[model samples]
Target: MTKPLIIGVSGASGLIYAVHALKYLLAADYTIELVASRATYMVWQAEENIRMPAEPDQQELFWRDKAGVKTSGILNCHRWGDAGDNIASGSFRTLGMVIIPCSMSTVGKIAAGLSSDLLERAADVQIKEGKPLVVVPRETPFSLIHLRNLTTLAEAGVKIVPAIPAWYHHPKTIEDLVDFVVARALDTLDIDCIPLERWKSS
Candidate 1:
């Protein structure tokens, strides 16, 4: 049973991507170790008019155990500093790790090998374990500093995917754009999904 870790950061914009990805992964029957940053919860409240899981005990928001059946078991949210957690080690096999809407600060920290929190730590573990690590950064008007940080991680084999949705998809709604990027990230992780169409030189 292959699983993936989905980390949501407060970097800015696009919580929908995390939600959609989590939904799809669960629907696909993959277990997920989840992490949501403090700022991410705040952003969810301000922008999306939603609340973050209050504590690790709020696992019901993600985990669903109905009539002793594990339906919708994709996400298992834990405290960011829980280094003693199961997903903290490479021995716990997983398909990959993704940081959706990854913040520049977090990106720099991970690039520089600083794992101060569980999300960063899990990402570091993924890299060290030689597993796929995809970072979804939603910043625009890129600075040299951002590019350098992205490049640094890229050189180390991390997939630094900027959350720039393709216009070629003819998106009808914001959700369409979000799904397009998430689908691309899943593709990088080699997860089979139905997403956007590729640009062709016609």
Candidate 2:
């Protein structure tokens, strides 16, 4: 079974994107190595209206109940310095990596080759190893700094997927829009999915 390394940071504003991605990936039987930023924990409270759980079991339960994600034990959380972790090195053999809601700080770090944390280290390994690295940045009103860093990462072969939801799908709810971007990201990883919409070429 081919498992992709999935990383979620707080920088993604539309938390639903990560949740939906998690749901689909797990359902597809792909084992994921997930890491959440400190800020991501706070954002779930401030934006998505979901509170952080005290225990790892509670965390898994919260995600399962709230986002319909499937996982056994503490599949959703990993320590920052757990370099002992499997996803930390290129030798671990992962198909790809995705950093949903990647922050400008993280983007710049990855672009410049900074691996202070496991998340950063994992991203570096992806780039150095020439594997697919997808970054879903949720910020809007792009600053020139953000654009340049993104372009740099893109040039380095990272898929800088901005969190811009497609309107052509005529989304009735927020979930529809979220699924659209998530499906697109999954597509980059070559994961077969019933994409949120079918394109009609004229």
Best by lDDT: 1
lDDT of 2 by residue, 1-202 (tens): 5555655554456777777777776666666677766677778878967777645466666666665655532255666556567677778787788888788888888888887777888888888988888999877788999899999998998887787778887899988888888878777887765456657666
For model 2, the stretches where C-alpha displacement exceeds 4 angstroms are 54-58, 70-76
Every model: Cα RMSD to truth: 3.5, 2.4
Deviation of model 1 at 93, angstroms: 1.0
Deviation of model 1 at 167, angstroms? 2.3
Residue-pair clashes per candidate = 0, 2
| Candidate 1 per-residue C-alpha lDDT over 1-202 given as tens digits, one digit per residue, 9 for 90 to 100 | 5655555454467777777777677777777777766677677778868676758767545333211224655567878777667777889788888898888888888899997777888888888889899999988888999899999999989997788888886899987888888898888988865456767887
The TM-scores, one per candidate, come to: 0.87, 0.88
Shift in Å, residue 127, candidate 2 = 0.7
lDDT, candidate 1, at 177: 86
Error of 1 at 132 (Å): 0.6
